[model samples]
Target: MKWKKLLAATLALGISAVVMAGCGSDKAASNGEKALVIGDTTFNSSNEEPDVNPHNAYAGWACIRYGIGETLIKYSDKMELQPWLATKWENVDEFTWKFTLRDDVTFSSGRKMDAAAVKQCLEHLIANNKRAAQDLKIAAIEANGQELIIKTTEPRPALLNYLGDPYGCIIDVDAGFEQGIVAGTGPYIATDIKTDDHLVLKKNEHYWGGTPKLDKITIRTITDGNTLSSALQSGEVQAAYGMAYESYPLFKNDKYNISQISTSRCFFGKMNFDPDSVCADPAVRQAIAMGIDKENFVAKLLDGNGFPANGVFPAGPAFGGDKVKAEKFDLDGAKKVLEAAGWVDTDGDGIREKNGKKLVIKWLTYPSRQELPLLAESAQATLKEIGMQVEINNTADNNQVVKDTKAWDVYAMANVQAPTGDPEYWFTVFATSNATKNQGKYRSARLDALENQLSREFDPAKRAQLALDMQQVVLDDHAFVFCSFLKMSMISKANVKNYTSHACDYYQVTADLDVE
Candidate 1:
């Protein structure tokens, strides 16, 4: 009843909020102590954030996002590379990179951070983390004093950008994981961690950057959007990470602060290209791409909190956004394309049939990301209008279902297309023929060759154009239907300070974060 009441009454109205369920109050900041609680939707195992251990399968997202870890390199507000743990880096050769580590840095383990510490951490990462090892492609590492040298297996043009990734968070491997936690050079040190529940953190007094603003911080895993909304509204939490777009109106006022920015988090569909699947048909793939109303979906269902995507990347960089052309939402055009390909509703049941088989799209998606299920349901309705039957299989066991390619026609998922602010990440992870996560198994010789060129390319302008060419190859094949780009947002109370949003969407809690 209280949560329902608070949902109707926005925090912008200045409701007398308390100290986050009184969980952090030790006489209510009597000695000028500061505490904060953040409700994050993407902290559970379902989002690949089982713990703060950076080496364990995307847990690095939690490691970096929660201020428990710091990377050697970080991205600026413009997605440009910035010095973090490492001060200055030099591209020594085509296959070698030299990094100058910060001499003043010390891990929470009380160990001095040097080239040896960083070298040990990176070596441990290469051995334990497969994804990081693959992205970094490190052949050998040499350390001398405060300088760290990394020799890649090949010429990695985007090596610096990859280093800015979450997995690049430097941790003290020698400290060991007592409870899936490690010593890091972040503003905060993770003290207590309970999976799917809460993570308690304390300020790192010897933090390298600056004295942390908050003395204590609690990050609560609130997966439900409504509960997260109510928690922040009732002051059960001071801030929220994954607020529903429909709930945006409730916090748009003086009492609340909404930090939002356009990110490369694209929600797209990968058409099943299995020979046995109906989506294997080119007309079906094209129709599927052209039928879904992305513009209306962004404007209405998304509450205008996203951009209608034209390609894998959003509109800004030379490689992504509107650099290339793709199919638009045209129902008539979709129907004509299907009809031309000999798929027609002969039975007049508003369901198309091709040679005795009905054009049924078995859409497989998960609900971990709030907007994904919404996209599936919305596409289901719109696809029906064009004589296509959509059987929705929205489930949490999507990873299991996807293993059987016969089960799905179009597998839709939300992904950060460019987490490292580079075009190669999306293609290498999802589009390349050798990509392990290539959901649709779509392949093109031209695309693979272009990727090879992009990998070795050192010039900035050439790399940008190469990325654009690769996007066109996928679009021409109708392999993936690019839907919309997410506008990442973080909702905080007016009293919270500097808990800002980043374009990279990796850095959240930082030394600047404070509570009034």
Candidate 2:
């Protein structure tokens, strides 16, 4: 079969490939011709809704709607807070915040969005335990006729960052249930949302912040990286979302035209910290960390879009800690640790033995992300060097791993950060929430205190210091051996320009994209 038809089938079936070509035909929009085309992997939030009304309910889902839904504040690329629906906001006291709303803004439904509207939106989130609702217990959300006042149980410096997320994006109280189309105060409006397919948007004519330059935008969720790269090359879509690193070489020569950002999606193989499991020993965990050659794994397994990680913070301004020194490749060291842990080869076979038990282990991973399976295979090979038998298991369904944690000795997966940069938000994966979290069920009281302190610390400098300290605590404890910080490679046709990505993973659609 021809590649185009093959690609069409794979795209329909969600399979990634390599080698792509096609010249896109320039088509004009129809009478209501204001739409933008965007490409992504998934659109439906965990809530499984095409669109929702209340902001903060769905992080990724909210972002798409929030752009149409205005927020109390906005954050620039430089991470500076700016006013949005709320003209200005200030701290009335350590526990109280006052926001003066902009009376001129109106929802697409022509309903006036005022202090009362903002109060209603915030109250809903506080009432429901939204994940991003970490800082500021939100003691109360009140509207003083014209101004909105919010009181917190304590002072929260990261409040602006949380509100800047899509969940904080405000929408029309009445148009909240409108699905398939996006409606809010953003510069653009979502007109159509197709499940596991595509999304279409147009500039908001009712936008109070002056009209956008482009008239329309469209976004499609194409799972195949090669197909997306081909779409970019073929001009089927102006830009493509996630690309596997192995495909990066195809566009390496083309410079100043195709734009790519070195993003941070850390990947690692997590262990089942079930106290009953052999991997529960920190010494065993460290040995496993030492056995895998991260530098080579990332260089060979990941191509070029990865960085070796020492801890959870992604090695940047947001992450700080006493450098625990990089994990070195030491086959002998791995052997030594295993020996110290009483893993010995008593039989003539090369595999280790401990009280008649073979050092056989199972590693679990999913195909949700393309890189995870390959990473797990490399781990299996690396562990074998120390007389340990390793098995590789790959499943498309993640619930299997969740339901059968005891069956898995090690599980490989990617942990994406929540909208709030706070480490506390991630405890659901580590805390004693039973096995309700992902990765290994590891817990530490020190980690708990550090996470709690960082959340409440309103001072930027102090908060950063605490975050660094928290990373060290995890490092010293060997919590899920840190691997590489994965980068998001965005391939786009030359015509697409000025596209931007947020700190949190979703792509924003607007008039910025144009077909030259």
TM-score to native of every candidate shown: 0.92, 0.82
Query: Residue by residue across 1-516, what tens digits does model 1's lDDT show?
Result: 322232234232211222243453421343345778888887887767789999888889999998989898899868888898999999999999999999998988788899999999999998998778878899999999999999999999899998888888998887887667778889988766778777877788889788998887778888788888888887778888988888889999998999999888889999888998999999999999999999988999899999899998988754566989999899999999999999999989999999899999999987767778889988998889988999999876787788898999999988888889789998988888877578789899999999999999999989999999999999999999999999999999898988788888888999999887
**Worst-scoring 10-residue span by lDDT in model 1:** 10-19
Candidate closest to the true structure, highest lDDT: 1
**Predicted structure with the largest TM-score when compared to the true one:** 1
Off by over 4 Å in 1: 1-33
Off by more than 4 A, model 2: 1-36, 42-62, 65-70, 134-136, 178-182, 213-215, 252-257, 262-264, 321-326, 345-361, 416-439, 502-507
Q: Per-residue alpha-carbon lDDT of model 2 for 1-516, expressed as tens digits?
A: 221332233342221111111224322344334333445543433223344344433533534532556567765543457787788888877777888888888765566778787777667656653454554468788887559888877776667666765666676554554443334677765555555555555566767877776665556656566676666555666665565666667766543144544444567666677876667877677778788878887888888667777766566665542244545678899899889989899986888887777877777766546677788878888889888788777765554554576777777767654444554444434442232354467777887777667757777788777766766666676666767777655665555565656555443554355555
Please, what is the whole-model Cα lDDT of each candidate in the order they appear? 0.85, 0.61
lDDT of 2 at 351: 86
